[model samples]
Target: MIVENSKVILSVKNLTAEVEGVQILKGVNLEVKAGEVHAIMGPNGSGKSTFSKVLAGHPDYAVTGGEVIFKGQNLLELPPEERSRAGVFLAFQYPLEIPGVTNSDFLRLAYNTLQKQKGLAELDLLDFDDYVQDKLKVVEMNPSFLSRSVNEGFSGGEKKRNEILQMAILEPKLAILDETDSGLDIDALRIVSNGVNQLSTAENCTVLITHYQRLLDYIVPDFIHVMESGKIVLTGGKELALELESRGYDWITEEVKV
Candidate 1:
């Protein structure tokens, strides 16, 4: 539940973006307040992923028009790294594999970097190990995975767990998870969703971009949005997911057109 007078963490106003000269997000507008969880659902090619990418400041997508404000600042002016530092995190749909970097090292570096930016003391390797170990419990990750290369040869479930581990450590103010439930079996999905629920608090916001209602079953959203073509045409409470799941997007699309 959102607190009384909870501040808005993110606001997108008439946000339009494109990739390689082709428009993907067209006049997207959203208001996410602290303590809210929002789910954006749509059919294929409806620009759900593109919206997340654009919010993360992906270089390939150019903002043609509109504004994105985060924490009272112009989000569009910040580069990706700066946005990360400012507590905006985007969990990729497909977590990348880095063959040379150990998961522990990569996580520590990222955690320490954010600490340094905040003018806080950085933890030594030993200290970071203990800190990250505690975070691993959020996702039920094993300690052995820490020594292995980052997501190298990790199964789909492991990769997704590692992503949650990253989130647990960094503790961003806003987390945008793009298709995070993809390619996971039931058990993995439950584990990941539980971690996300543990991480959510009254001070942070979460935006989940997905294509199915199963994900919402685990990580319930305060609001559900339907995107058609390149825009969100409908917004409803969690019950809307059930409606969409039963009747499909055709009815929503047709309703919007009418």
Candidate 2:
């Protein structure tokens, strides 16, 4: 039985989805509780990105079966915009650049758009600006980020930090990050991870989808799940990431029947 007010915030049961009629997710199941970080580690072509996309209501993929419940709500039934308004946040691997959209304009609209969905009043430009300045301090980001177009001409490091900055401001109940450690130098990784860590609280959860164990060192997920062929084959604590790093995914691949 699933509880409406349980500590588990998101419940995914026997989830199966597809892209253009080709099945991608084959009965994937996961349970995420508040304040917990779950790292999904898998090899390339293992359907990690598919899982992230399906959760965000991307139309390119179709749900073949299963249920996704978020805080007692049917998540799959909602549209992508509604999904964002309802608290699902996905940080993309390759962020698109909008040359005309100012970063500050985008952030302000995103924050207030969410606020409106919750039946709360929207924050004016002044209030939102103040809030953004404070969040930038957390990532050691500069004020110049506000004036630039959204992700336009941003370095790899700047783009990742910008994603974290949005996460910090939106404060979604469930945040799904896909390969966030990619293209990041040591300093940028530290700054981005630090921002992510600071955003976590007793009321929110973080889900990291990554291929390498290097990211686990900074984020320190509460659970590590190994995915192969769209299903979780192994699960353990932080040490599992280390073990995978030592022995490699070969152990999991060899054990899994495919």
* Candidate 2 lDDT: 0.90
Q: Each candidate's root-mean-square deviation in Å?
A: 0.8, 2.6
Candidate 2 lDDT for residue 236:
90
RMSD of 1: 0.8
For this target, which candidate reaches the highest lDDT against the unseen true structure? 1
Colliding residue pairs in candidate 1: none
lDDT for 182 in candidate 2 is 96
Leading candidate by TM-score: 1
The C-alpha local distance difference test score for the whole of candidate 1 amounts to 0.94
lDDT of 1 by residue, 1-258 (tens): 456799999999998999999998889989999999999999999999999999999999999999999999999999999999999999889999999999999998999999999999999999998898789899999999999999999999999999989999999999999999999999999999999999999999999999999999999999999988888899999999999999999987788789
Write model 2 residue lDDT over 51-129, tens digit each, in one string: 9999999999999999999978999999999988888999988887989999999999989888887889998988888
lDDT (Cα atoms) of all candidates against the true structure: 0.94, 0.90
Q: How much is 37 displaced in model 2, in angstroms?
A: 0.6
Worst 10 residues of 2 by lDDT: 1-10
